[model samples]
Target: MGDYDEDTAFLGQTGPYFWTTFFLLNTVYLSTGFNGLYMVFIGSAPTHHCLIPDVNLTREWKNAIIPVTIVDGVEVQTQCSRYKLDVVRNLSAQGFIPGRDVNLTNLELEKCLDGWSYSKEIYQSNIVTEWDLVCDDQWKVPFASSTLFVGYLFGSLISGQLSDRFGRKKVVFISLAAQCVSVLLQSFSHSWKMFCVMFLFVGASQISMYISAFVLGTELLSKTMRVLFTTLGAFLFYCIGYMTLPWIAYGIREWRTLLAVLSSTSVVYIPLWWLIPESPRWLITQGRVEEAEAIVRDAARKNKVEAPPVIFKESELHSLTPSRKYSMLDVLKNKNIRCITLMCLLLWMAINIGYFGLSLNTSNLSGDPFMNCFLSATTEVPAYVVSTWLLKKYPRRALLSIFLSLGGGLLLLIQFIPDTLQYVALALEMTGKFGFTMCFSIVYIYTAEIYPTVLRNVGIGMCSSAARIGSITAPYVIYLGTYNKVLPYILMGSLTIASSVVNFFLPETLNRDLPETVEQMQECQGLCHGFRKTKYVEDEGRRNQPIQREAKV
Candidate 1:
């Protein structure tokens, strides 16, 4: 058997164990989807205006006190200011009326000293309602959302090392528990600061669990199964959770209650510690040969396949070598790898910023916030389907460039769409989201394919870190919308366009073997020059192999 086949031979590529593991991992992924984007609903700001305190004045007088003001150059009921209530009451006693008997615009205005009243048409309660995070305090909403990504940033950096050191299964359970506890605690916070602090833990734990589960699933599944699990299995489950979030928020209405419900869902996975087995591959690397063999034996039994006394040959068992440890510096030391890494980082940052920026802006879109969120989540389904199909058929560079450009172009067009055609603007935004989702999905596979096995993990890790940086900046990008409704779109659209053009410089990985060494990667630099002809020649050569050898193989 070849080295690649030898490594996975004992775990029957498809069987009971594989299917069970797949289902269990996907279940965890489903729950993660809920916690991942719940911030959209949790921190949503509903329509509100300054509270006109009752000073025993007539209803007309009360109405007259809250004056209309120009916000973003549009005259609307002011959110943060009210007419001096004492003066308004005296004016009302004198039979003064708004607009006709008195010029309300010329009257002195004061801040919302009595606080604000929120419209409860859609939401009964949220972080914005619970703490009055509107008007002057509106900036806190995006800051609170950004804290979650800050946790994601830290979680992404640490989870990999922790998983490798302690084992994937252990890390998965620990992170899962941490996430559940943190989310639950976050629900009961009395102050926004307390909520934000706990939310940091929630974000960290959520991403850590996701990363660990992802690594575990990839390691446990077969090669083809790995592709399916990455693209369709866990990711689709996440989409389902995301699609369900809007409904959950709509139903619960209260942020605290919603969080409690979502956190309790984690309890369902407590039993998975027994159901999901430790990775046999990781065990073998750790020199736990007997334990690894035992897991394989159980898997074969579960699959109803007859097992040999010993699954691996002595040579196969000893095949693992302790190579020199490579770091991020090593990736940058190579000229080709360095260039690829830089391009991937920039591309990843742009995609992440655009994706999250669009997601967080759903509330501000011209439709029901819940329905808009649902639409955004729903778009991912087709995006994933299309991305899976295209990854198999098209060159990575071309697909990424095309998709990025398409998404960016759509976002750019949205700026030209007038408010009168808001539905059209919304449609364009959703379409842009679809394009960004495709780019997001493609970049993962592309990054993995570009780097050799030795440095693949490091290269992808660096890119992911860059993505977190983009995510950390996303809330602020969305916050820019408060200043100018089109600012976020303009910025995200421009960055995406620049990234798309840069993607053309990247080499194509389609039809090429995964490079196993840095030297092999350097040699494949020119492979993308005549991609179709090279692929055809390689296919034809394979077809011409001797019939006897083919039958033997």
Candidate 2:
């Protein structure tokens, strides 16, 4: 809706950029999730001793571990899945003969529970507190995870609404302040409850950040560039931040210190008032015409051009008017919108669950996590390149469907591979990651197209929140011991396949004016009608060029 202007390209100054950078990188909260937990194999568990009697032969034999025993003349040692080992109480409970085989009983387990058995229950681990990373209290880890997700869930729902209700810049300020306070307080937390309370606030704060960033970036760009800046720039940067998180955590080595460093970076946002301009579109929508005019005037002055006689007519700038008013009930009433919503939600859930679930599997993959994580992320760059090329040439629906199918197929194939060929499996997994990342990029563009402008933000928010639901589930799937390791991958792959099937029902968005009203959405009819207009435009442009050139000659 807006013309090219200097304000469209940059975030007025570097301060806002710094703020954006810091917020984007603050994923250290998510980064630390399973990183510390995965350290169980290499770290020590809290221990207690259990005495074995009437079996001494040598000093080494006397010191034999209580939880281990010779079964049928074969020695078998087992421990709980490194992350869940904290629940083991007594050595005899694990398999050891405390005094003799006849003396063991579950009712008298306290003998092993005390502090000397040095043997944890089989496959049970409490890696969250192995060595006090910050030496703080031990039980706050899972609470922190829940609090952050709660914050994210709250933010995900409310941020878009806030940006629409207030101006995007104002909401940006709000999110920044709230997140900063939460991060700052979380750092100072002396107990689990304090951390939880602070994280709830922090999660709410991120809503402002996402909404503000999207709005401000799209403010002055053309309709096409709006897609570029919002879809490509912001989304890509965020992914880059996600990809780099593991490396940063590895470098820092302590989760608490990493979180503290991320929080302190917020102070850099204080200067954003001078760096980023308020969103002009939001200004018009909020009835701040004068302020909106001034922002445009400032842009013209910086470009050494005169401001327009009028900044832009109110009628042309933005309109959310549809032929009929849309209530939440209306979304369900409309078959197309309902179909689009449910499909998008399912797609979102699957993507988040699979993406992060697999990410946490870096620990399960043999060899160094640092290398494995980095190598997987490295594939995303080429993914973006390929996506950019294919999207321009083919329908997004087709390309996305294909990518989804490919990702699912690769994941399923992973199960057939022998354990020794795991690096090959990892490579296949990266290919799947590439496929999903491309899908991730396309959905933002596609889902935004399915709704009229009036409900676009709400639609996007709801769809993304579904993905957040998947994000919440992902950690549990990988680490909760609820399902097997390959299960999340299979689900992600299957969901993508389902999405590809569903995509066929949705209309393609190409060479069509954005439907600003319900009437336009209804009248657009099909892709053929829209492409016909594009053909007409090309014909007109070609017709004018030769006459103009001959006249010049």
Candidate 3:
């Protein structure tokens, strides 16, 4: 507090900010229904046995089976001869409470239901397939994600305008509660339609969390640490979700069980409300001078130092005059913003197209699907470690566009390899993974930094939703790969290349601030207009950097 810039003291951490944020993020992340584990959400039936409900089979088929129905038009009430009628009635009300009473055929050579039984079929999948998606029958998987993006899209539009309207701390607090309930309902949905409905609500909650919470990190850290640590979330929670999922994947055979297990973990966040500090920056912005200064004072006490002058307080709060409202249309009405929006959206779309597409395509990659996905994700841990340093020195647009091309290129080259070069293809996939992972982190920082703070969340949300558009298409590409292995790679590669060109029209954002409105964006070229270059020249220099060279190896 004593040595740092007056502007940044609000940004640096004082309480258990890091741990509290991690827990909040982990909550939404686990419910994201990522990978096959999330396969539970869309009701993809597990490849396992089911309890064959007792039904009145033809007399010949009925001998060994429990008769669920009778010819008298009365329900046989489950012909478990070993159990008393009263026992069956009480147990029936519970509806297959596993381990309670309906033991799955424990003793005799009893007939049982298979996975395709009505209950099992309904139990396995969510109603997302109804959207008539092109992704596996699991098209709903990405659609479910789209609902979330839609939620994010809306949140960004609303939260960016409204979060500041309220307070950063309040918006995040509200988002946390909203996200918890939305995800829980989605996980426990009784019908596919209901599930989709839940997805929509939960998606909003999710975006609110993403926008508000992500902003919290930036608000809590120093400028030096702001971009770096805030974006580090792109890596931190990602790795956690990536690693944490595999263990859950194997642990739960039932999709419902999987979702239940994941959704329940969010409950730990309830106590975080009492722990984490409110955003002082947000307080200052909303004209809560006294409260904002109080937060600063509390920090002074905790750090054992004196608070800064009253003039410093006036600077932050006075600048925050209540002004014109923001809306999604704000990005479109201005040329520079429109251009930046287009570029960021396309980049967001491409990265997810590659990221989630490749992720879902793990079914086609060699080895255990879960393990391969996990190992591939583990690659990002190191990618982010290197990215934190590299992003600062480089131009955001140039570096990201080149990484886009590189990611796209490796994907295309993998198609040229012979089946004899299975390992070669896998190696190429890793290279692409690393590039996209880096781009994924960069895009978030770059997008937020480029947009004005007024439309910051909306701009990022639009990009995130656009990313979902790519995401929606991604699963279908992989689903097709089920029939043609090379199809997804070829299509994904082409999309990436096409989107990379959009970066040319956009401004660079390297160590910069976002605009509040489109008017401000039109005033300047973009957030960082200092440097922009063609991907080729950038790649050449990157190739020379022996430590972090653009080599496939």
> Which numbered prediction scores highest in TM-score against the true structure?
1
Clashing pairs in 1: none
On a 0 to 1 TM-score scale, where does candidate 3 land against the true structure?
0.69
Tens-place lDDT digits, model 2, residues 1-553: 3333443433333233334433433332232222222222222233333434433233432443334544335565322211112222333345544346433223222232222223443212223333232112222443354455666788877777777777776787777767766666765767556756876776667655765666666665445555555545555555565566566556655435655665666576677666567777677666777887787677656555666576566665544233344555766665556666777788777766666666555655656666676766677667766776676677866776788788778887887777778788888888888887787777777777767786776677788778767766765565433236567666666776786676675667765566664433432222122211111123642421221211110
Q: 66-158, model 3: which lDDT tens digit per residue?
A: 434352244543422322323444445555443444453552332222222223332333343323222233455545555554555576567
Q: Count the backbone clashes (under 3 Å) in each candidate.
A: 0, 21, 18
Q: Give the alpha carbon lDDT tens digit for every residue of 131-154 in model 1.
A: 999888988998898889989989
Let me know the TM-score candidate 2 reaches against the reference structure: 0.72
Candidate 1 deviates by what RMSD?
5.7
Better of 1 and 2 by TM-score: 1
Clashes of 3: 18
- Using Cα atoms with residue i matched to residue i, what is each candidate's TM-score against the true structure? 0.92, 0.72, 0.69
Candidate 2, overall lDDT? 0.57
Per-residue error for 192 in candidate 2, Å, reads 4.2
